[model samples]
Target: MKKIIISVLLLGLIGGASAYYYAFVYMKNRKFDMVNAEAASVDASVLVKAYQENETSANASYLDKVLLISGTVSATDQTQMGERTLTLSSEDPFSGVMVTLDSAEAAAVNVNDQVKVKGFCKGYLSDVVVTNAIIVK
Candidate 1:
């Protein structure tokens, strides 16, 4: 009886440790390749317009989905943490598609440049937000 109890406790400890390592260590180190990911292609202006017209419908289609957006770069910004973001122009001057680039290579993009970016849509808040983006063109 004593041996059986000790064996069960040891198995439980091993199982717990394996679960923790897989969740934290393995998953954290895994990188998502956005460039190669399957994505819905869209124009930045159209994406913004869809969100502006009907947020619920837009969310149903775009929210949390990978998107490949093409547009003219209206602005670029670098956060204090060295994170780079760019805004794509839309028909509505007040709103645009905001994209957070995944790599430093995207920093080379300049305003007014026509470019393509792929990212995960994070829904709208005035601007359509896209995260983990990579400049495609």
Candidate 2:
């Protein structure tokens, strides 16, 4: 009985140590620095169309990946977080790609301007959301 209890305690200790290592040490050192990642360059219309046609396949290809997209700005909005969000016009009237940029940077862009943007895709919600966007051109 004592030997069984000791073995169980040893197993528990090993499991706890492994969990701590993964949850704290490993996770704390991980980075999601998408700004510098290699990205797939695409047109805004194509990206929006792909998502609208098949969301699952689109997510697999684009979600969490960095993208460089060129499109005409349809509208710009200032979010509660003070981030500037721009709606890129798509061929489909019902859908578009929403790019979030730093307010200071987005201010330099005006509605109706054609520009190239780089960002991390955050999947869709009526519109595809691309976060941490920077104007590439």
Candidate 3:
């Protein structure tokens, strides 16, 4: 009886310590910086089409991955968080590629400008949202 009780308590302690290490130490240390990360280079139209055709597959492939996309700038806005948000035109008029960048980067972009941008694909709502973006061209 005493041996069984001690063994159970030991297993519980081990499990708790493992959970704490994973949640605090292991996860906290892993970081991917979108600014300098390697990304898949694609056209804005193609990106939008993939989502339109099959959103589930598109999200699996693109979500949380860095993408370098080239397209015409449709609109730009400065968010309250001081980040610049841009809408890049897709071949389809309704769905556009939304890119988020630093205010300084957004300042240089104007509406209808042909540009290349790199950012992390953050899944699609109505638009394909990209965050932590930077102007590459």
Q: Which stretches of candidate 1 lie over 4 Å from their true place?
A: 1-11, 104-107
Name the TM-score of candidate 1: 0.86
* Best model per TM-score: 1
Model 2 poorest ten-residue lDDT run: 101-110
Q: lDDT (0-100) at residue 137 of candidate 1? A: 58
Looking at model 2, residue 43 earns an lDDT score of 96
| TM match of model 2 to true structure | 0.73
Check candidate 3 and list the clashing pairs.
Answer: none
Residue 18's C-alpha lDDT in candidate 2? 97
Q: Write the per-residue lDDT of candidate 1 for residues 7-43, one digit (tens) a residue.
A: 9999999999999999999899989877689999999
Higher-TM-score candidate among 1 and 2?
1
* Model 1: pairs clashing at backbone N, Cα or C within 3 Å: none
Against the hidden reference, what TM-scores do the models get? 0.86, 0.73, 0.73
Top lDDT model: 1
Error of 1 at 73 (Å): 0.6
